[model samples]
Target: MAYVTPAPLTEKSTRTDALTPLGLLTVLLGAALSSIDFFIVNVALPSMGRDLRASPATLEMVVAGYAVAYAVLLVLGGRLGDTYGRGKLFRWGVAAFGLTSLACGLAPGAWWLVGARVAQGAASALMLPQVLATIHATTRGERRAKAVALYGSVSGLGVVLGQVLGGVLVAADLAGTGWRMAFLVNVPVAVAALLCAVRAVPDSRAERPRRGDIGGTLLLGAALTALLLPLSEGRATGWPLWSVLLLAAAPLFAWAFAAVERRAENTGGSPLLPPSLLREPGVRRGLVLGLPIFIGFSGWMFVSAVTLQQGLGYGALKAGLTLVPMGLAQFAASILAPGVAARFGGRAMGVAALVHASGLVILALTALWVPWSSLGPLALAPGLAVCGLGQGVELALYYRIVLAAVPAARAGAGSGLAATVQQSCLAVGVATVGSLFLALAAGPGMREAFAIVLGVQVVGLLGLAALSLRLPRRLA
Candidate 1:
């Protein structure tokens, strides 16, 4: 792929640069593709295990490999986009994603699939940051706000859609492809988006792009790997010596990463993630808020999928269908998020947290009281829908809060840093929350386990609600 240099735009000019509707759609498609892949594989895991004779440990890797790789490389990918050209990186990322998806679909064994998943995640890292960066750089004021909200909506919907689509595709067995179709489907979508992007997407780069922070990048990657790897694999692997050691070293690596970044900033070198960015009150508080939200969200999705399939003995299609109401509710709430934010200001997040907690409470009650034989998707629909609505609103508000203060020049870096936080929390959520549920299920039975997990999530939501009070009175 030839590197296309981005045309320079002044901060003044960038604020006025109108991102075409088609361009917005194209980038949003990229966002959807990346988000969907993360969750789609959850539903397909059973099929994958059956077909490939995958051990539980290997199955865990299929999910963790992509998540950890994506989380680790995201900041670097954002930096590359800012230094080079976002449009060029976006095209390359999409193409790579398509190819990697092909590799995943065609993999003949479990380990090959894990390798392919990691590569696919790397491709996703290259692509996803550009979506927010592009929106931030090319649009300003109300348009930018709306675009970000839409992106949030698309992201949340993608999570629900991925599992739903995965179930449908696995059950459909299109062309006898079975579980592979979930991945193979990305190929055509990527091609179409790639072709459309050339005409629709405008090229943009940071006004004063700096040299890559290789030292900071390496340390950040190492730190995230040390933290996430151990958490993800520990339960399945029986908490081995290596996992324990890695977990212990995670804090040390993180401290080193922080020290290196601070040093680089002091020396006037561009750190991969500028520590000063966190000094922006919006950026700092938003990230702190996002940690619990994403962790709870991803954990719930993973546990719900597993409980529905294994505990309830539901088919892939049924398990996937169960989440449709949630997806629809989230989609609706996202469309309304900007106006809600405008009206309620930061209080909207508190309201969203309360709403989310209510849904969890409802789900917990259902789990505790309902007979195992009688519980079904319908029984869970109201809670799921309510939960989705809260998630959509909270996510939209969270993105707005985090990026509101970021300068257009540093959009890629800012967006990348935010994305890294979101993705890493997502991985951790699955590792920690999913692990908790699985362990509890083994002893207390699925119903008790489900209720306990919901209770834990409700507590997290309460914390989020309290923290939202600290946000600035109004969004930028």
Candidate 2:
């Protein structure tokens, strides 16, 4: 099939050619795929290990490889959408994602599965940024606000649903495919998304497209890999020499990346991530605030899955079902967040943080007091639901706050940079918090370890509340 280039939207055309409802749904579907894949494999890890005879380290790679690759390539993906066309990239990305998901489903060995997962991550990197970029470019004012809120709702729901769906698929074991079904399901979904893209999804790109920043891309990728790779693998592998070296080198790469970006901007070349963009108060503060929020969020998810399945002896489906209350509450809160933000302004974030921390406190108490035999999904539901509500609010506001000041001309780049920060932090959260839980579990037992981790997370939320107070009273 020949590619049909979409007409570029002028300022006037943008207002006139609103993103159709189906178009928003199509892009949101694509966005959900990326977020869903990040966590879908969590519940399937035990199944995968049994079937493949995979080592613990390889299992970590299965999750980390996808996240690391996705985080590293996101900015380039955004730039490509800006220079080419978002609709074209969306289709290409969806196609690539489908193929990669197939590769993962059919892998014959542990290493092959890891490689396929990395490729799947790369495809996600390509697809996800376009969703935000397209929404940023195509809609404005109240429509833009609603689109973004829905995006946030989908994103949060996707993460929870990934685990839920993974559990259901693994338990169903369709045709005895077992864990592979978790990935194979994406094949049909991607095909549907591609078909919808052809009709419903509009193409949009930067008005003044900038050339890809090769030097900056390489430097940024290296910097992120250096930082995230060690944190992800070091604990499981017993913190080897290579991991320490990578950790030590991370800062150097980051400094070099900064210098290169600064030079590119000074030379009038478009940097992969412009330093000037970071100077924007919205962008800077949003990132600062997001670090703790996502770090705590992902960390909790990672450890919760492990504790439910391994410590409590819950089945995959049961463990996945454990999060259902959280997912439902989160979706509800996300839908209501825009109105809440409009009324309470940035204070809503602080309130949300407090709510999230309260949930963590509840979980910590339950973990400490409840006997293992009596504790189950029912015992955890209230805390999880509260956390969900807080997370929903935070996520919607975070996107609105971050992208509020970005120019339409740089929508792709700006959204991509924001996403990279989010994805990278998620990977780090899993590693750091997961490692802490594992270490404590080994010594103090699962119950004590869980309580400790929740305590740490609560402290992070307190910090987030403090930071949120600094956000401008009105979100854009």
State the local distance difference test value for candidate 2: 0.88
Task: Give me the overall lDDT of model 1.
Answer: 0.89
> Among all windows of ten consecutive residues in candidate 2, which has the lowest summed lDDT?
1-10
CA lDDT, every model vs. true structure: 0.89, 0.88
lDDT of 2 by residue, 1-476 (tens): 11112235654235524689998999999999999999999889889999999999999999889989999999999999988888789989999999999999999999999999999999999999899888888887677778888888888899999999999999999999999999999999999999998888877887788887889999999999999888878887999999999999999999999999999999998899999989888888888988998898889988998899889999989998999999999999988998988888888899999998998999889887888878989999999999999999988888888888777767788889889988878878888898889889999899999999999999998999999888767766
What are the root-mean-square deviations of the candidates from the true structure over C-alphas? 3.8, 4.0
